[model samples]
Target: MKADLKQIQSPIKSEMAEFELRFKDLMKSRVKLLDHIMNYIVRRKGKQMRPMFVFLSAGVCGDINDSTYRGAALIELLHTATLVHDDVVDDANYRRGFFSVNALWKNKIAVLVGDFLLSRGLLLSIDNDDFHLLKIVSNAVKEMAEGELLQIAKARKLDITEEVYYKIIRQKTASLMASCCSVGASSTASSPEIIEKMREFGEKVGMAFQIKDDLFDYGEEEIGKPVGIDIKEKKMTLPLIFALQKADWLEKRKIIHLIRNKSENKKAVNEVISFVKQSGGLEYAKEVMNRFYDEAMTILQDFPDSEYKESLSSLVTYSIQRKK
Candidate 1:
């Protein structure tokens, strides 16, 4: 049976609860308008996956302490800032079924809000003298920006190779998770080697997490996003990239033409999905995702058995196996 998030969070339930209160306090602002917007953002938060990674990794490495909570909050504040900015850049109206910050407040205010959140995160670390944790997360934020720019540059041409895909996802999705684990370990005063190991483990889990997200574009039984959204947006995911690789020149050109020109048409989108499915793209992607999942599990085996270790292991499984 698949373990749900509630069960996986059992080891760190109290820490997570305390982190929530601390996080809310960190987000508080003296400005009334900013305070109101921050509250709105807090109310619409999704599942607290990043913080779980932080707290769990800290527990595995050593004891969870004040620094661990600060580390988790730092990740959340920085990540939320990115999401707010992303909505503005994408001109998206909704995020996770709620109105985006930009949608309600408009672009100008939204941009400032993102900046505010970023500063708050920085100050939170600086005030606590958690420079080590700060360094880990700040590098991740930089990599994330670089990764987004790389994806945008590549998306225009739609010629991303498998290796390029790995690079993009590693920086775009995996880097933040890597920082979360590293920060967790660092907050516990773990040695440099152990921190690096947790970072690698987090990176592998993140890679698997992203591939699983890409698979949902093929219309899995339970999907969080609408099917064919990636194709419509002309984003070349692993399955589509692999399928195109297997096709003859003429067939490849035809699908590319369809995606470039007629993606708005439901029929064209369906054709592309059908092509990927028939070409064994889904199976290949699943195989790759499972490989990363296994690698992450192997890394987890380095740590001793404990509730924290078990929950961390379960969290890795839940990430790739989640229906969403």
Candidate 2:
């Protein structure tokens, strides 16, 4: 599941280059801890998908200005901050094939670094003086926190409804993506109507991204994490939710028993996995994700044709189809 940056279509490659440099520059502060954290994240190497959107939206709308760099860096900082906090919350050992911040350092350090990054994001956005951008991003942060809490509440509740699962994903994952697109459009002075359309595109694509991620928990061959990570963690994701809905009473009871037992070993988890496969939920979830991806592409078509539009479509395609 490697994403090739060269494959991304570019109408304004020169501007994007400048935007990338500016983003890197913005991330480069003199503080030792902050510098180290930023360097680690940069070396880990994300797709920079949100930053791409920022630059692309600005270019598609018109020119690359200071707002473009501010928006791009702010989104990157927000995303990196979230990743650090998520690693601590998940107690994760690995991320992007490297040790997570929480794995290398203590949780307290990771939390502090995450806080710094998030505060930096807010400050940079405020410096830009776009009250609307600040409001949108602030709301996204709040929603993400609420979503985490909702997932925590639903944990181990085998009866967690698909609607609740969707709500969690919408708040935790889609909201940030929505903010990314909205900020991109707003940074370029795009009309409110245009920003709304872009936000819709990001939200739909983000939902597809999250659903596909859930699907991978069952499909990924490598088992560094548990085979059924979400299940073991007592988190009910879409595939399991769908399986419970469509399963017969007997099968449903078996799932409920396994979930309730809480001490189910490798063999028991494997059996549950087989049950989910037999119930056709995995394929159903994949189909649903594909449908969302297709719909997102349809929305991209509504925007006038451009290389940025093409990359945005390609990004959604890659996100849903990716294995990791």
Candidate 3:
């Protein structure tokens, strides 16, 4: 069953509200044009799941403080900047079912805004002497860029293995989540051992989260895009990768031809989805996601019981079961 986001967040509702204010204040700009764009971004913000992770992690480990708010600000700042740049790179007009920054402001302005946001995030850390926090976020940014480039490099051939797919998502998606947990622990002055454990826990949950998102490509629900958009984009997701591994040479070639040569074809996309479903690829992916979820839960078990700990567990459930 899917976990309710509102319920999962109830534990930190007040802290999240404070974090929202801090996030907005951090994005404030002297230039009117930049301020307008920042306002738009704030209005259209999604769940703010990253900040929620930070606050919850802090609450579980120690207590929320000024440092916790700063950590949340840094994560959201970098995360938003990346999304804007990603829209320009992917030529995507929509994000979270709304117009992307690139679509509304043009690529030049969008790119500049992204750069400004990134610089602000870095400066926020440096100015406050949060060098340790800077190191964690800087590494996540580096990993995300490498992960994206790797995926694009392999897109032409559509030749990603299960191991390679894990590596890509770890860098592209899990790195940020890991940062959230690490930053949260650090903000509360948790020991190095505890911080490492939280980081690993966040990484595992993030891995499961991405796989769950991949599963939605084959789901019947109408998410922001048409079904099998990943197929249309020739992206190699877990189910398709597993299906290919199980197919004979001739069948494998046929499937690859559809993905590589006829991905735009509605019939081909439907056929590929059907093939993956029939091959038990979806089931296999779900099992993998569950394994990660369970591992994350085990890590949390080492922490003492508290309302915050239960909420963090609920977050793990929410990550895998979220429809969007």
Candidate 4:
């Protein structure tokens, strides 16, 4: 049975709080201006999913160790670092419905703050002397950067395939999640078999998370993000990839032309959504999400019953049904 997100709060809650406090404390040493921007980014907040995964997986495997808390904090720091750089790359003025650090503090400051966060995370990782954990997180950081670069380099290419889209999502989203789970299991020096299982669970859940988030772009106003951002940015997500497969030559040509011109404004976005609907892209995407969520839960069944396991399972289910 699928778990409820409501029941999955305990392990993640404390760890998330710890990460927030550490982030604040680490940034306190910055100069006034840099400190202000760092504070703003912190205040915007997030679901803290990466840290939550770290905490919950550790709990599910056994008990919370000091490494667990520090690892969780490190993941959040790494995540924040990426968001800061991402704002610069996307030229995004807003995120989480607030002004981005790049918008308020300028790109250079934002980039520097991001670097500081990364450095802080690395410093903290060294305190634990866990080179293995560092390696896992470092790989995530590298993959995320490469993923962003891959997307930018391939932006607006009509020839972009579903395989390519999945590749990017795995790097940009799944890799960190895999690392988070691996670190959790590693804290216990768990068996390689157990570690691999946890990694698979996280990767599948992370992919589901991104795909569900992408669907928000086309959802009704009451249900999701403002539609058209991806189209405007020329980022081809799963829906678009599915639509490409199903659309006829004429329709495909039209979409390819619009993507090439980067002409998908609000109205064009609406038309694309409609076209995707008619082409059954949304259905295909939803089907894929459900399948992945199911697979993630299947992996969790290997673990004996526990509240942490229940919560992790619930998180997977929630990823599909989340409105925002």
Candidate 5:
């Protein structure tokens, strides 16, 4: 059965509800403009997946407490900071179907807001002496920055290997999720070993989640981001990489040329999509995604059965199976 987020969050429903209130308090600012911007951000929040990961992992590892809430807020604040800055970097106007911080407030205001959020996250951790959670999330923030730079550098050359691709997504996407789980476990005073285990489990789920996102570029469904958006942006993903590896010299050159020179053209984008599909790229990518999913499930199996465990399992499933 397909897992809906509401059902998957049942175990931590109350905690998540409480989290929303605390998160708002944590983001409150004395400045009128900053307070207004923060309110806009709060109202347009997404599904709260990261906080759910934090609370659920805390539940599974130990007891949820004040520390757990702080940890969740820390992750959300830092993650939101990144997203706000990312909008400026991407010159993107929308996020989750709403006007982005930059779009509403301009790049200068958005940049300052991002910095504000980052500082808030840091202060929140330092004030509570939650250095362990701070370290975990800080490392993730570093990895994410490096990953974005690495992808940008590689995209220029169009020379990313399968190995490089994995490194990119692992650092970019998996690191944050890994930190979320580790923070959750650490907040409960779990042993380092268990915290490490949960981190690894989260990484595996993140790997699967990103691959599923890459697959969406091939028009897997009519929802999600538009098909070929990645290709149009000259961002090479798993399926495209796999197809290129299997192509003969001339075909490889031709496709690369199209991706580099004519990616914005609809016909060229369609052609690239056709080439990847014919190369069986989508099937190959799905196989790898499922492998990561299985690995995550195996890691989850190490913990005894509990409602938290079950909900975490469902959350993993929902990530890969989500329509958008």
Candidate 6:
């Protein structure tokens, strides 16, 4: 469960350093206010996992190129934009342990910053005629929006079935990862066959990744995300959904009532957490998550072995094993 994340980057260190410069250059603006906001974004960036996915996928299938850097930048740009707007929507004050764009600049400026970042990503692709990469990322953006909307629509009811849960996670979480892999392959001028295969690989890994995140809600782990925050938000994640499936008719009713009305109550959230653990929800979710991880490994195993493949395989393991 312990990966030297620095070792994970060793294979692509030079490319990553180059990408840092590209990412910063891509975020620059002439407007003073926007420049200030973008500067803050540069200062408080996360682990850059999406870019790693892009580079690793490229290394596996073909050579890394300028387009690969741009592909990674596009994912980061879109992801940062989404976080900015999501903070506005959630009325959140922090992101990745730093003050959010909304917290510093307020909702209006935060929203506009999100818009600007999004447009910059799109224009970068269109201007370069990187149409194939653009198509992949654009579709992901569409799916992510629909996924959030679907989750919001379902939140009031707490009615996410296993099928619906898969749909939500696939769009909300998996789409971007899938696009990262596809864009990586496309950057190297990979064949359509190879690109499609990488997309599937990324999607499955992303699904498992989200499930592991949901499992954290029932644990004592202190991730950046608060324990039970999903439940508090009325988001029906896999662990809870699976737990409810195992409940008897009356137990199910009690759980639903608590989720709908007592979600804000810490004691009630703990009760729900205890219920989920005792009902075997966590075990069931881990099982499904491993299945996805193994499937992704199988696809990767078919590829030739190299430093790149080893690093990518390690990433698949780290996704499920990460503490936060």
Q: Global lDDT of each model? A: 0.95, 0.78, 0.91, 0.81, 0.95, 0.91
What 10-residue stretch in candidate 2 is worst by lDDT?
219-228
Clashing pairs in 4: none
Question: What are the per-residue Cα lDDT tens digits for candidate 6 across 176-289?
Answer: 989999999899999999999999999999999999888878764666368888889889988889999889999999999999999999999999999998988888888999
Q: What would the per-residue lDDT of candidate 4 be over residues 1-324, giving only the tens digit for each residue?
A: 654544567647666667678767866764788777777777778776677788788877877887877777788888888988888987999988888888888999889988988998899889779777888899989998888778887784656688998899999899988899988887777788887889898899889888888887777437577777777778888988999888889989988777667455666667787888888888888898888888988889989898788787777676677778
Tens digits of per-residue lDDT for model 1, 186-287: 999999999999999999999999999999999885657899999998888999999999999999999999998998999999999999999999999999
Highest-lDDT candidate: 5
Best-first order by TM-score = 5, 1, 6, 3, 4, 2
Model 6: lDDT to the true structure: 0.91
TM, every model: 0.99, 0.91, 0.97, 0.93, 0.99, 0.98
Which 10-residue window of candidate 5 scores lowest in summed lDDT?
217-226
RMSD of every candidate to native, in Å, equals: 0.8, 2.5, 1.2, 2.1, 0.7, 1.0
lDDT string, candidate 2, 30-60, tens digits: 8888788777877786667777766666655
- Model 3: weakest 10-residue lDDT segment is 219-228
Using alpha carbons, what is the TM-score of model 4?
0.93
Candidate 3 error regions (>4 Å): 1-3, 220-225
- Any residue pairs clashing in model 1, and if so which? none
How many residue pairs clash in all the candidates, one count each? 0, 0, 0, 0, 0, 0
lDDT of candidate model 2 versus the reference? 0.78
lDDT for 275 (candidate 5)? 99
Question: How well does candidate 1 score on lDDT at residue 320?
Answer: 86
lDDT for 96 in candidate 3 is: 88
Give the clashing residue pairs of candidate 3, or none.
none
